[model samples]
Target: MILFRGTGAAACRYLESDRSRADDYYLEGGTALAAFTVTDGGGEVLATSELDAEAYAGWVDWIDPLTTKSMGKPRLPGEEGTTKHGSPRFAEMVVNTPKSLSIAAALHPEVSDALDAAQGDAVAEIRRFIALHSVTRVGPRGHQEVVPVERLQTVAVVHKTSRAGDPHRHVHFQIGTRVWAAGKWRGLDTAALFKQQGAIRALGTAVLAAHPGLAQVLDRHGLTLDPVTGEVAELESFNALMSKRGAQVEKNLAAIEASWDEAHPGQEPGPVVHARMTAAAWAKGRPQKRPTTLAHEDGWRDELAEAGYDPELFLQRRLPAHAPIDVDDLKIQTIASRSLDRCAAAASTWTRHTVAEKVTRIVTEHGVRATPA
Candidate 1:
């Protein structure tokens, strides 16, 4: 599962350099948060499963509109975690909203509910959340930019082959702030969402007691059960528990592998045997030849020279210094520039006529601005 947050521009920047690595990590169920303060800092979520390619495509189709593009690239593996640059694709990080306000909580109704919902509708819920929080506003110069918010960008769920996560799935979402229909954005105090005693208690019962011995080890590792909910606690405590559990599980697996090697020295089968009787199989037809791709001698001249092989011809090709900007790049650059402009405006003073005059001059000279609406 990959959770994306922040501005599309920021997300694009992160994606360009490490798209492959990011995808690799995403398959591992990592969350990626991006937000563009200069643009609407909405968020998006993606879950990765071993679905067939068609199912994967279906998932993308369901999620594409909510996000900005088909090439779903979260923050590249090495970029900073937060989305600060303004990208049209950028959205906030999504995490668990309060149980009361969470759409997942509402859909599930009961924590153990197994009811299935339509994929389209589920994706709609996600899109609704993004649109409801996306920034859209006109500034002093009637410039548009996405306003930044500390919203949950995404939640990721990773299903492992073994008893990872006690088989509990889904990375939760917690969103704060509201993007109103009136094109205004406001912050929502979502701390109350985390104050659920029942949830806490449930966590304690389900995860903490799943394996009691492991629970004791978790406690020894500075991980503790919450007093009020009797559930495994969060923040640093949850991380500590996970780390310790992972280490123990790894150790156990290593021990099992070592034991297997000791029990069976080289091969597990009884013993290698040589058969006494053998008959030769005859092929009476013409031999099959391997196929090869067409080779161009013209292009091989440079390589041939380097390898000390003279060539009769050389291919001359001129490559451009830069490729055309893609939609994502344009969006990111626009958002970034706008953000810088906003900052500059904030740090300075201005008069209304001065702004109007500038606008008038532009309108008079260019007739209209055609770059971005």
Candidate 2:
């Protein structure tokens, strides 16, 4: 799955890369943690490719990246109660690996390595999508027009688990909102990113499913990606087993809502207030990291063993060898018909994007890929 979060300048508190202690190789701009790093491309504006605490502070606060001094303009009379520069500092896209994939990674090093490579490849593809669709508005009010721009300022932080300590492997791909377009810093046109979340999720999962190393590893371990759901084909039952974190959030939300109803005595909250209440509930529900003597991966293994999952049985060839699929004209016609029907069902108005997303859905669900020359 993919999640896009709009963030103000001060995302560093949680957005900072995990700083675990281990034997580490140094990166170009800064030190490397086991999981991720902060990078910078140029020294001018956003400077780093990885996450930088000081530079990020400056970047979000509208200060010079090198100088770390405030460059924020004095607010205009009407510009009260907004971000430092009246624009969000960054947009975060979370690319999450499937639960079964995460469990597989914990079970084996080869799976872990393959998962990393697949995730990297998928992230690169998503970046290309961002570069192609990124835009900025130029000119005044009614006369304004959107122009394509580049968003080179990106930081990806790979995380291993959810706050509730589930085996959730994901990357936080944060795109800096400061885009250099037409010799000026401008806010990115995030409408594309927001509007195409489903497409992004589909594309990312498709890449994971077809990745050679990852696919080979899965096959060896008697696993395969479900063409439609894009999760471990044999592990549908894992959903109920692995939804601890999400379940906690839901439980907390219910409790909070109950309390709110009691306090308010029959008053219904407006949309804005309800949204804030939900946010508060999430934060309240978020679990703090519990200190563990055993290594995290080791702990996951123990849990799996206790759950009665036999590794030997898992390794045995379970999925059948591929049978020849007849991709005849009728199959093509059926796919087309289903794609169009899905588009119609999804929206009243249709555009190229809508059709494209629906087609992608149909293609992925069937595990279809472009024929190589």
Candidate 3:
């Protein structure tokens, strides 16, 4: 599974701070640095600065000074803007654990390499998907045209456990806000990116399925899968346990929000305010135990069995066979079908030519070459 969330300066600070643990922050493709230059679509350096709390809180003025003044509200350094609504300074793509591989890695430390390989493949797929799908429109009115963003710069941070100290392997991909395209920096068309998230998740699952050894490990561990969803139900208990801290934080936030609403009357707080509140709440409500003890394999399996999931069935069941289809073609077809379904839902009619044109535009926009018939 993959989740997307827009983050503000406060959140960015939390990620870079010691609170998140320095060891978990991974600098993909290079070593870590205090500050770095933001680049344009052509890979030209735009600005050099550290993306610490100060930078994010004061970024609106630097990024769009004219607009900041016109709005009549100056954002203080370290303060998430209270008036700004839709402008997200950064985006996070959370790559979640594949149940089978996660369980395997937890039980047998030796399988960590295979798990890493699978995760690497998942990340590569996500990067390719982003390259092809990341786009923005340019020009005015009728002259508007869609163009792909040529580059994506992200810091992929891997975490070994959930906030509740449960064994949860995931990556937080911090994607830069300003993307390069058409010889300039432009805001990413995140709506399009969000639309393709499901496809990207499916692609990750497919990549995992390609690794037979991982599946065999799942079988050995007694993790049964749902015949229909192909998802392992046994992991739900673990997920629920891991989610306790997060659930508490959310509860605290909800209470805070309610109090704020009561005090503010007709006014609604912006994303910045919400982010600040959420962060504070999270910090205050964090569990006392920073690290959790890993259960023995036999004990973990017993717990799963106690949760009513049959371990015997997990051992007997086999993973569904991979469908024989070209991965690229499958992606294209899936996107096309989704597009058609949306059109149908909207009661919009399209001729064959129109559908073909739409698909062609998507293919061209993403730089996907058509497979020879």
Put down candidate 3 lDDT per residue, 1-373, tens digits, no spaces.
2222233443543443212221332234443322333433443434444443444444432342212222123343345744334355545676777554455455555555556666666666655555556777788869988887765444455564443333456766555555657776666776776666656655554555444444444446665433223345555555554344655654666677678779997565665776566566666756554332222344444544566656456556645533333336548567688668745765577554345434433433342222211
- Candidate 3: the clashing residue pairs are 41-180
Candidate with better TM-score, 2 vs 3: 2
Error of 3 at 291 (Å): 6.2
Model 2 steric clash pairs? 38-50, 38-51, 39-48, 39-49, 39-50, 40-48, 40-49
How well does each candidate superpose onto the true structure, as a TM-score? 0.23, 0.71, 0.53
Better of 1 and 3 by lDDT: 3
For candidate 1, lDDT tens digit of each residue in 217-303?
333333332322323342222232222233343344345435654777643221111000000000112124210110121222232
Each prediction's Cα RMSD? 27.7, 8.4, 9.3
Each prediction's whole-model lDDT (CA): 0.28, 0.59, 0.50
Task: Order the candidate numbers by TM-score, best to worst.
Answer: 2, 3, 1
Count of backbone collisions within predicted model 1:
38
lDDT of 1 at 265: 65
Off by over 4 Å in 3: 1-9, 13-83, 98-101, 140-143, 216-246, 249-373
